[model samples]
Target: MKLPHPIQYQGSKRNLASQILQYFPLDIETLIEPFAGSAAISVAAAYNNYANKFIINDLNKPLLNLLELIIEHPNKISNNYEKIWNKQHINSVEHYFEIREKFNKSKDSSLFLYLMARCAKGAVRYNKSGEFNQSPDKRRKGTIPERMKKNIMGVSSLLKGKVKFKSEDYRLLINDISEKDLLYMDPPYQGVCSNRDSRYYSGIDHSEFVVFLEELNNKNISYIISYDGRLGDKKYGEPMPKHLNLEHIEINAGRSSQATLLGKKDITYESLYLSKALQKRIINDNQNTLIMKELKYA
Candidate 1:
């Protein structure tokens, strides 16, 4: 199924959601996303009925608020978006920067959505003072109002009552996670964005993140992390420590668009790390499936 995504995020797992979800158990009480950019995984999980409830959290307050509006008050957000999008007809670039200035001051979710749609490459970049500074994509205007409405409404219908929105540090959120809940983490890439990359307002320390993973293991919580990977021979981030005992899988994310444009056939592979407990559950689920198939044949 083509999942609905109201926003275009640069590193969104929307395209890779199905492949990542293959490891999810058939039953999940809650699916928590600590770094829920666009909440792509949560949206996919809800679409596939893989989780009964969802907790979507992000440190980016404006982005999280935009998501909340998309999931709870679709009509209001869609209408506001249309108004903003329509104004750009006269001078799209000027209108985009105007919206960006307003968003930085007001932090209005609707304005944030408009800027996200019109931003160059859908890349979220912030200055030292935490301002949205990405330039507009002059090649084309943002998504049309009709398509935006459809996507916003589709996401709202799927997750309105089933989701809880949060704007908090991931560390604070993880403390409340229970064994029944499954956590899917797509944290800032260690090397690329972990050290205060302009893409984020702030960056997580690699050592601190490792310690956080250790704590999760101690609590026996199940998690799936989309941490790091490579493009051709060049790797992006440091590998997860072996001591964590997480099962690592590399997903082929297909050819890199940048590489293709450069006339290089470099395939981008993303790293997926699964907690040991989750891995064991997946193995058991597969065995049961095979057993059921054999019995039916007999």
Candidate 2:
């Protein structure tokens, strides 16, 4: 089976696969990913064959169409991605923006995926004019993984019919969700990554998110949310929030995205991993040292 998250998405939850799965109930009948970006959580969920039904969502229509094609024709996608993997061109800012704008206009999923890989910083940047504006990276490394196409196909097969893809307001989802369902929401980060200037993340509001969290707090259904951590870092070693009775964790959110905003604030610090019991365990173990220090200093 092709790996489901064939197309790379910014802020993918591949990192959260293990943690999210652990927190998820074993008896889930339906798996819902409200912010299904990289299929990180969804791909892993489908691969495990855990849920009898899967509900995947993202606001980007083009990205959704890519998912549609993946569901419909895996081999065709692999062949198209092959064309992308083999092609070469001058790598520059204008060249990237130009290529991306032109390519976005095309009705081709492989082209979209290829540009996403080749563009500047892998950020899906855009202009107010609705143009792709991320410059090209002259020094970018590696071809699209030699195994990328195969992986996508693998995921597609695993998700066959067990999956339902949708593009809708996450708030609207509460209408259909049941008390027993599990919802995974990895919305764009609060300050920088939220869907204001960013093209890829789309519009998810803080108020809306807070409401969603409140609903989760009120409902009997289980949920896990991935959002920005404080300290301008992903591993927030600070004490858990008093109100939520939450947990905080410190994990290397990968070395590449270690920037402050994504992390590259140029300072050294970390953010918290907000979750339920399992995160409490991970944080209580190793991060307690720093937590105590922060307590002493604060």
Best by lDDT: 1
Q: What TM-scores do the predictions have?
A: 0.97, 0.73
Number of clashes recorded per candidate: 0, 18
Error of 2 at 139 (Å): 3.9
Query: What's the lDDT for residue 40 in model 1?
Result: 94
Q: After superposition, how far is residue 69 of candidate 2 from its true place, in Å?
A: 1.9
| Candidate 2 displacement at residue 269 in angstroms | 9.0
Candidate lDDT values, in order: 0.90, 0.63
Cα lDDT tens digits, model 2, 1-298, are: 4334566555666755765565555556677888887667777877776676878888876677777667667777777766655555444444545556666587466667667777666667766655556656678632465576666677777776777788898887887677556787777666543435655546556666676666665554456666645433333322423555445443444444455356354332223334343344334545666788899999
Cα lDDT of model 1 by residue, 47-110, tens digit: 9999869999998988898999999999999999999999998999998998999999999999
Top candidate on TM-score is 1
Query: lDDT score of model 2?
Result: 0.63
